[model samples]
Target: MFKLSSTVSQAPISINDSSPAAQASTRLIGFGQTCPQQGCGGASTTLKQLDTRINPDNMCSAGFNASTELCVYSTTSQTACYGDNWQRVGTCARR
Candidate 1:
Protein backbone atom coordinates (compact mmCIF):
# COMPACT_ATOMS: atom_id res chain seq x y z
CA MET A 1 0.00 0.00 0.00
CA PHE A 2 1.17 3.54 -0.78
CA LYS A 3 0.63 6.70 1.27
CA LEU A 4 -0.64 9.78 -0.59
CA SER A 5 0.06 13.37 0.44
CA SER A 6 -1.92 16.36 -0.68
CA THR A 7 -0.04 19.33 -2.07
CA VAL A 8 -2.89 21.65 -1.11
CA SER A 9 -4.16 21.88 2.42
CA GLN A 10 -7.75 22.96 1.81
CA ALA A 11 -10.62 21.52 -0.16
CA PRO A 12 -11.49 23.94 -2.99
CA ILE A 13 -15.17 24.57 -2.42
CA SER A 14 -17.30 27.29 -4.02
CA ILE A 15 -19.36 28.96 -1.34
CA ASN A 16 -20.40 32.41 -2.54
CA ASP A 17 -23.61 31.68 -4.43
CA SER A 18 -24.28 28.28 -2.94
CA SER A 19 -26.36 27.62 0.13
CA PRO A 20 -24.63 26.61 3.37
CA ALA A 21 -26.05 23.10 3.02
CA ALA A 22 -24.99 22.91 -0.61
CA GLN A 23 -21.51 24.13 0.24
CA ALA A 24 -21.16 21.62 3.05
CA SER A 25 -22.50 18.79 0.91
CA THR A 26 -20.22 19.57 -2.03
CA ARG A 27 -17.02 17.59 -2.49
CA LEU A 28 -14.08 17.82 -4.84
CA ILE A 29 -13.74 14.95 -7.33
CA GLY A 30 -11.41 14.14 -10.23
CA PHE A 31 -10.39 11.33 -12.62
CA GLY A 32 -7.29 10.32 -14.56
CA GLN A 33 -5.64 7.51 -16.67
CA THR A 34 -2.51 5.40 -16.18
CA CYS A 35 0.17 4.18 -18.58
CA PRO A 36 0.36 0.66 -20.07
CA GLN A 37 2.62 -2.01 -18.67
CA GLN A 38 6.01 -2.87 -20.14
CA GLY A 39 6.52 -5.98 -22.40
CA CYS A 40 2.75 -6.05 -22.89
CA GLY A 41 3.47 -5.43 -26.55
CA GLY A 42 1.36 -3.39 -28.91
CA ALA A 43 -0.80 -0.43 -27.85
CA SER A 44 -4.05 -1.94 -29.23
CA THR A 45 -4.20 -4.77 -26.68
CA THR A 46 -3.00 -2.76 -23.65
CA LEU A 47 -5.31 -2.45 -20.60
CA LYS A 48 -4.74 0.50 -18.29
CA GLN A 49 -6.46 0.93 -14.91
CA LEU A 50 -8.33 3.95 -13.61
CA ASP A 51 -9.20 4.92 -10.01
CA THR A 52 -12.41 6.62 -8.90
CA ARG A 53 -13.21 8.29 -5.57
CA ILE A 54 -9.86 7.13 -4.20
CA ASN A 55 -9.68 10.08 -1.85
CA PRO A 56 -12.10 11.99 0.37
CA ASP A 57 -11.53 15.00 -1.92
CA ASN A 58 -12.17 12.70 -4.92
CA MET A 59 -8.76 12.97 -6.59
CA CYS A 60 -7.90 10.12 -9.03
CA SER A 61 -4.63 8.61 -10.09
CA ALA A 62 -3.51 7.72 -13.59
CA GLY A 63 -4.71 4.42 -15.10
CA PHE A 64 -3.61 0.92 -14.05
CA ASN A 65 -4.32 -2.72 -14.85
CA ALA A 66 -7.33 -4.49 -13.35
CA SER A 67 -5.08 -6.69 -11.25
CA THR A 68 -3.27 -3.76 -9.56
CA GLU A 69 -6.58 -2.38 -8.35
CA LEU A 70 -6.36 -2.45 -4.55
CA CYS A 71 -7.90 -0.59 -1.64
CA VAL A 72 -5.88 2.49 -0.63
CA TYR A 73 -6.19 4.24 2.73
CA SER A 74 -4.15 7.32 1.82
CA THR A 75 -2.98 9.52 -1.05
CA THR A 76 0.16 7.42 -1.49
CA SER A 77 -2.03 4.49 -2.50
CA GLN A 78 -2.74 6.30 -5.77
CA THR A 79 -0.93 4.83 -8.78
CA ALA A 80 -0.72 5.03 -12.56
CA CYS A 81 -1.29 2.12 -14.97
CA TYR A 82 -1.47 1.85 -18.76
CA GLY A 83 -4.19 0.29 -20.97
CA ASP A 84 -6.47 0.91 -23.94
CA ASN A 85 -10.02 1.98 -23.06
CA TRP A 86 -11.20 3.47 -19.76
CA GLN A 87 -13.53 1.27 -17.76
CA ARG A 88 -14.67 0.89 -14.12
CA VAL A 89 -13.44 -2.53 -13.06
CA GLY A 90 -14.44 -2.05 -9.41
CA THR A 91 -15.31 0.37 -6.62
CA CYS A 92 -13.58 1.44 -3.36
CA ALA A 93 -14.60 3.40 -0.28
CA ARG A 94 -12.68 6.02 1.72
CA ARG A 95 -10.99 4.67 4.83
Candidate 2:
Protein backbone atom coordinates (compact mmCIF):
# COMPACT_ATOMS: atom_id res chain seq x y z
CA MET A 1 0.00 0.00 0.00
CA PHE A 2 1.04 3.61 -0.64
CA LYS A 3 -0.03 7.00 0.62
CA LEU A 4 0.60 10.57 -0.44
CA SER A 5 0.71 13.87 1.41
CA SER A 6 1.29 17.48 0.37
CA THR A 7 1.73 20.90 1.96
CA VAL A 8 2.51 24.39 0.63
CA SER A 9 4.54 26.99 2.41
CA GLN A 10 2.93 30.30 3.19
CA ALA A 11 6.26 32.03 2.81
CA PRO A 12 7.07 33.86 -0.36
CA ILE A 13 10.21 33.13 -2.34
CA SER A 14 12.15 35.83 -4.07
CA ILE A 15 13.42 35.31 -7.58
CA ASN A 16 15.74 37.18 -9.86
CA ASP A 17 17.39 39.63 -7.58
CA SER A 18 20.41 41.89 -8.18
CA SER A 19 19.56 42.30 -11.83
CA PRO A 20 19.24 45.72 -13.43
CA ALA A 21 16.59 44.42 -15.84
CA ALA A 22 12.94 45.25 -15.37
CA GLN A 23 10.98 42.85 -13.21
CA ALA A 24 8.22 40.81 -14.80
CA SER A 25 4.79 40.40 -13.28
CA THR A 26 4.09 36.95 -11.89
CA ARG A 27 1.17 35.07 -10.33
CA LEU A 28 0.86 31.88 -8.36
CA ILE A 29 -1.66 29.34 -9.57
CA GLY A 30 -1.57 26.64 -6.87
CA PHE A 31 0.43 23.90 -5.19
CA GLY A 32 -0.20 20.24 -4.54
CA GLN A 33 0.85 16.71 -5.26
CA THR A 34 0.06 14.39 -8.10
CA CYS A 35 -2.29 11.42 -7.71
CA PRO A 36 -1.04 8.65 -5.45
CA GLN A 37 -1.28 6.26 -8.32
CA GLN A 38 1.49 8.18 -9.97
CA GLY A 39 3.67 7.64 -6.86
CA CYS A 40 4.40 11.33 -6.61
CA GLY A 41 5.22 12.60 -3.16
CA GLY A 42 6.05 16.18 -2.10
CA ALA A 43 4.76 19.72 -2.41
CA SER A 44 5.21 21.85 -5.49
CA THR A 45 4.59 25.48 -6.36
CA THR A 46 3.01 26.81 -9.59
CA LEU A 47 3.50 30.20 -11.19
CA LYS A 48 2.34 31.92 -14.37
CA GLN A 49 3.27 35.08 -16.20
CA LEU A 50 2.81 36.71 -19.54
CA ASP A 51 5.33 35.89 -22.17
CA THR A 52 7.89 38.46 -23.13
CA ARG A 53 6.18 41.24 -25.02
CA ILE A 54 7.28 44.31 -26.87
CA ASN A 55 7.73 47.29 -24.62
CA PRO A 56 10.00 50.29 -24.11
CA ASP A 57 12.53 47.89 -22.62
CA ASN A 58 13.02 45.82 -25.76
CA MET A 59 11.77 48.21 -28.35
CA CYS A 60 8.48 47.87 -30.35
CA SER A 61 8.88 44.24 -31.28
CA ALA A 62 8.00 40.87 -29.72
CA GLY A 63 11.65 39.94 -29.65
CA PHE A 64 11.31 38.19 -26.33
CA ASN A 65 10.74 34.45 -26.28
CA ALA A 66 8.18 32.77 -24.09
CA SER A 67 9.33 30.04 -21.74
CA THR A 68 7.62 27.38 -19.68
CA GLU A 69 9.02 26.11 -16.37
CA LEU A 70 8.97 22.55 -15.07
CA CYS A 71 9.99 20.79 -11.86
CA VAL A 72 10.70 17.12 -11.52
CA TYR A 73 8.68 15.10 -9.01
CA SER A 74 10.94 13.63 -6.34
CA THR A 75 9.24 10.28 -5.96
CA THR A 76 7.39 9.71 -9.21
CA SER A 77 10.00 11.28 -11.45
CA GLN A 78 7.18 13.01 -13.24
CA THR A 79 7.39 16.44 -14.78
CA ALA A 80 4.79 19.04 -13.82
CA CYS A 81 4.14 22.51 -15.21
CA TYR A 82 3.85 25.44 -12.82
CA GLY A 83 1.01 27.07 -14.73
CA ASP A 84 1.10 27.82 -18.45
CA ASN A 85 4.55 29.17 -19.14
CA TRP A 86 5.72 29.31 -15.57
CA GLN A 87 8.50 26.92 -14.61
CA ARG A 88 8.84 25.04 -11.36
CA VAL A 89 11.93 25.98 -9.41
CA GLY A 90 11.94 23.73 -6.36
CA THR A 91 9.94 21.23 -4.38
CA CYS A 92 8.93 21.29 -0.73
CA ALA A 93 9.30 17.65 0.04
CA ARG A 94 8.32 16.23 3.39
CA ARG A 95 10.26 13.44 4.93
Candidate 3:
Protein backbone atom coordinates (compact mmCIF):
# COMPACT_ATOMS: atom_id res chain seq x y z
CA MET A 1 0.00 0.00 0.00
CA PHE A 2 1.05 3.58 -0.70
CA LYS A 3 0.25 6.92 0.87
CA LEU A 4 0.16 10.42 -0.60
CA SER A 5 0.23 13.92 0.88
CA SER A 6 -1.84 16.64 -0.79
CA THR A 7 -1.23 20.38 -0.45
CA VAL A 8 -4.75 21.40 -1.57
CA SER A 9 -7.50 22.36 0.82
CA GLN A 10 -10.39 20.08 1.80
CA ALA A 11 -14.07 20.67 1.06
CA PRO A 12 -17.28 19.99 2.96
CA ILE A 13 -19.46 16.95 2.21
CA SER A 14 -22.71 17.33 0.22
CA ILE A 15 -24.94 14.29 -0.01
CA ASN A 16 -25.90 13.44 -3.61
CA ASP A 17 -24.96 11.00 -6.39
CA SER A 18 -21.37 12.20 -6.01
CA SER A 19 -21.42 11.83 -2.24
CA PRO A 20 -19.55 9.13 -0.31
CA ALA A 21 -22.85 7.67 0.86
CA ALA A 22 -23.99 7.13 -2.72
CA GLN A 23 -25.08 3.59 -3.60
CA ALA A 24 -23.54 3.32 -7.07
CA SER A 25 -19.90 3.59 -6.11
CA THR A 26 -17.30 3.42 -8.87
CA ARG A 27 -14.22 1.15 -8.82
CA LEU A 28 -12.37 3.04 -11.51
CA ILE A 29 -8.65 3.84 -11.31
CA GLY A 30 -5.52 4.29 -13.43
CA PHE A 31 -4.72 0.62 -13.99
CA GLY A 32 -1.31 -0.42 -15.33
CA GLN A 33 -1.01 -2.04 -18.78
CA THR A 34 1.58 -2.92 -21.37
CA CYS A 35 3.21 -0.48 -23.86
CA PRO A 36 4.89 -3.12 -26.06
CA GLN A 37 8.67 -2.82 -26.69
CA GLN A 38 8.74 0.65 -25.11
CA GLY A 39 7.40 -0.22 -21.66
CA CYS A 40 4.18 -0.44 -19.63
CA GLY A 41 2.89 2.75 -18.10
CA GLY A 42 0.26 5.50 -18.11
CA ALA A 43 -2.50 3.03 -18.97
CA SER A 44 -5.95 3.08 -17.35
CA THR A 45 -8.86 0.61 -17.27
CA THR A 46 -11.62 -0.69 -15.06
CA LEU A 47 -11.06 -3.84 -13.00
CA LYS A 48 -13.46 -6.79 -13.03
CA GLN A 49 -13.84 -8.16 -9.52
CA LEU A 50 -13.82 -11.96 -9.15
CA ASP A 51 -15.24 -13.89 -6.27
CA THR A 52 -13.60 -17.27 -5.62
CA ARG A 53 -16.25 -18.20 -3.11
CA ILE A 54 -19.08 -18.19 -5.64
CA ASN A 55 -16.99 -19.38 -8.61
CA PRO A 56 -13.90 -21.17 -7.39
CA ASP A 57 -12.71 -22.27 -10.88
CA ASN A 58 -9.77 -24.27 -9.43
CA MET A 59 -8.20 -21.10 -8.05
CA CYS A 60 -8.20 -22.70 -4.64
CA SER A 61 -6.41 -25.79 -5.97
CA ALA A 62 -3.82 -23.43 -7.46
CA GLY A 63 -3.06 -22.20 -3.92
CA PHE A 64 -5.22 -19.06 -4.08
CA ASN A 65 -7.75 -19.02 -1.31
CA ALA A 66 -10.95 -17.01 -1.25
CA SER A 67 -10.28 -15.60 2.23
CA THR A 68 -6.95 -14.00 1.38
CA GLU A 69 -6.83 -13.85 -2.40
CA LEU A 70 -8.29 -10.97 -4.40
CA CYS A 71 -8.50 -11.85 -8.07
CA VAL A 72 -9.27 -9.30 -10.78
CA TYR A 73 -9.22 -9.10 -14.55
CA SER A 74 -8.84 -6.49 -17.26
CA THR A 75 -12.11 -5.83 -19.03
CA THR A 76 -10.42 -5.35 -22.42
CA SER A 77 -8.48 -8.59 -22.57
CA GLN A 78 -9.22 -12.34 -22.54
CA THR A 79 -5.94 -13.12 -20.80
CA ALA A 80 -4.16 -11.35 -17.99
CA CYS A 81 -0.50 -10.38 -18.42
CA TYR A 82 1.88 -10.05 -15.52
CA GLY A 83 5.40 -8.67 -15.29
CA ASP A 84 7.81 -9.00 -12.43
CA ASN A 85 9.35 -5.51 -12.46
CA TRP A 86 9.83 -5.99 -16.24
CA GLN A 87 12.23 -8.85 -15.55
CA ARG A 88 9.94 -11.70 -16.56
CA VAL A 89 6.51 -11.79 -18.18
CA GLY A 90 3.69 -14.33 -17.99
CA THR A 91 0.14 -14.72 -19.17
CA CYS A 92 -2.84 -16.41 -17.52
CA ALA A 93 -5.84 -17.28 -19.67
CA ARG A 94 -9.26 -16.24 -18.47
CA ARG A 95 -11.59 -19.11 -17.47
| Top candidate by TM-score | 3
Model 1 poorest 10 in a row by lDDT: 18-27
**lDDT at position 53, candidate 1:** 34
- Against the reference, the lDDT scores of all candidates come to 0.33, 0.32, 0.31
lDDT of 3 by residue, 1-95 (tens): 75658665755433232222212222222233444332446443544321111223353356554444323333344333232111111112222
Name the regions of candidate 2 deviating beyond 4 angstroms: 1-12, 16-66, 76-95
Residue 11 CA displacement from its true place in model 2, Å: 8.2
Clashes of each: 20, 1, 0
> Quick one: ranking by lDDT, best first?
1, 2, 3
What TM-score do all the candidates reach, one by one? 0.17, 0.18, 0.26
lDDT of 1 by residue, 1-95 (tens): 85557576866543343122211322222222233354445443434343323332223355633344333332235444332221232333222
For model 3, the local distance difference test gives 0.31
Query: Which model is ahead, 1 or 3, in terms of lDDT?
Result: 1
Model 1: CA > 4 A from native: 1-36, 45-51, 56-80, 83-95
